[model samples]
Target: MKNKFIYLIYVILSNLPDFYMIRVWFRNITKLRAKVLKLLPNMEISNGVKIYRGVKISRNSNLILSKGVVIKEFCILGGTIAVGEDTQILSYTKIDGSGKVTIGRDTHIGRENDIFSHYHNISDKNILVNKSKECFQEIHIGNNVMLYSRVAVMGGVNIHDNSAIAYGSIVTKNCEQNFIYAGVPAKKIGERI
Candidate 1:
């Protein structure tokens, strides 16, 4: 089928180190090299992983992704994004963090999932121009959790192991083990099968 053919071609293209060498050559010639190098602050990136075009990584962060992790199209991230082996962050999953985000082993975050560690206090009218410094918190997603499509996790939340967060759920608290939670401010629906 045409889809299979396209995938095969993609696999072949991804394997070609010469293509990456050419990319490096082209990148070095451009004015964007400084801007590109400014993105990675502290990170150890392994080879053979696909970093798509237009991906903006942050400058001050610890990002260590193991092999075969495909960070797909237009996915912008910043923070401690330590993806375990074979984890896939699909398209447009904004793993933005001012604090810390530790995604445990073997997790898959679906498209457009905003896992933010913390946010600002814009409501404080007393402070002029919101002059208060960045407020950060920890977001710990346990092992083997599948965050379905469009899931948004707020700051300071801990998700337990073997848990699955359903689509469009806004998680604002701790999710227990082996549970399925889906809703605004996501709650426990039932036990997973």
Candidate 2:
């Protein structure tokens, strides 16, 4: 379609001489970026969604960004990932949705966070780690959740609404609602008011 052609033009122009200059030009042009975002299949992006430069979105994936969602620079969103309204994913965050990742409304995910919806099977000691098949599971982050910097969310974890995860935490289990979780293999530290 016309949008694809425009995106192609943008890609070609961005790869030309003075790459940084062209990236800056594209960064300043929100409309141009939005137009490209609209071309993604199964994307239900609402109004006021801001996807900054250096963000990588997979071509063959379902990405839904609700109203007022902001994905900052260098964020990689792959596979099936749905971000709810008013959610902000800061810079350097990588969301792997090889299974499915559903982030609820009003959520704030800080920088350098790694969220994975799939994991490799390491049950068999005989099998090579790299050759093992990946196990897929859904990761759900409920409404009003706040995940601080450097948090790692593994697969099959359900983080309920109104929860805040502290920095440098590794979430391997379900998080209770309306509480603050911290430390490795994150535990409920205290209740959130």
Candidate 3:
């Protein structure tokens, strides 16, 4: 009940335009917000994990942040998201893990990157208002991966280890390990050196 109350407050705050400024202020004062989040049942934060202000998280969501993870300011990351050790998620990144999003160790998610683990239901013609079942798929981002700015990773995509996704790319499928991908649909451009 307590966790749900906090989640409701966060949901309401997220809708506010000045929420980002409020979060940045919270980051400057202390780690109180982070400490409060530690009380959530599904959240696990190891030592040295830094969550900057203006980051809206869900209490009911399973969010595991390993050691040395730094989530920058103004990031809306929530749901069943597991960020590996030492991974850095830059500002303005939005991760929706309503299904599951697993980001591996030493990964760098650049600014404005959007990651989604679920797609809205709009398939059924009979029920236009209600729609069909939601499409929920997991997103697996492997170790040492680099997702550049403005990257949009769709649901059910697997970004393999040591891969680098170029800026402004849209990933729709599985990316091969140790390669560089770019452009719409994110084709393999070259091998990672």
lDDT for predicted candidate 2 compared with the true structure: 0.85
User: Tens digits of per-residue lDDT for model 3 on 1-193?
Assistant: 8888766654554443434457775443324445556676788878777766577775667888888888877888778999999999999999999989999999999999999998877766676755667789999999999999999999999999999999999999999999999999899999988
Model 2 alpha-carbon drift over 4 Å, by segment: 1-28
lDDT of each: 0.72, 0.85, 0.84
lDDT of 1 by residue, 88-157 (tens): 7887889976778887777788998899987777677788656855678899988889999899998899
* RMSD each, Å: 10.1, 3.6, 4.0
Which window of ten consecutive residues has the lowest lDDT sum in model 1? 29-38
lDDT of 2 at 128: 98
Top candidate when judged by TM-score against the true structure:
2
Q: Give Cα distance to truth, residue 176, candidate 1, Å.
A: 0.9
Q: Judge candidate 1 at residue 11 and give its lDDT.
A: 38
Question: What would the per-residue lDDT of candidate 2 be over residues 1-193, giving only the tens digit for each residue?
Answer: 8646755654543333333457676454543554567765566678787766667776666888888888877788889999999999998999999999999999999999999999999899999999998999999999999999999999999999999999999999999999999999899999987
Q: Candidate 1: deviation at residue 141, Å?
A: 0.9
C-alpha lDDT (0 to 100) for residue 144 of candidate 3? 99
Question: lDDT of candidate 3?
Answer: 0.84
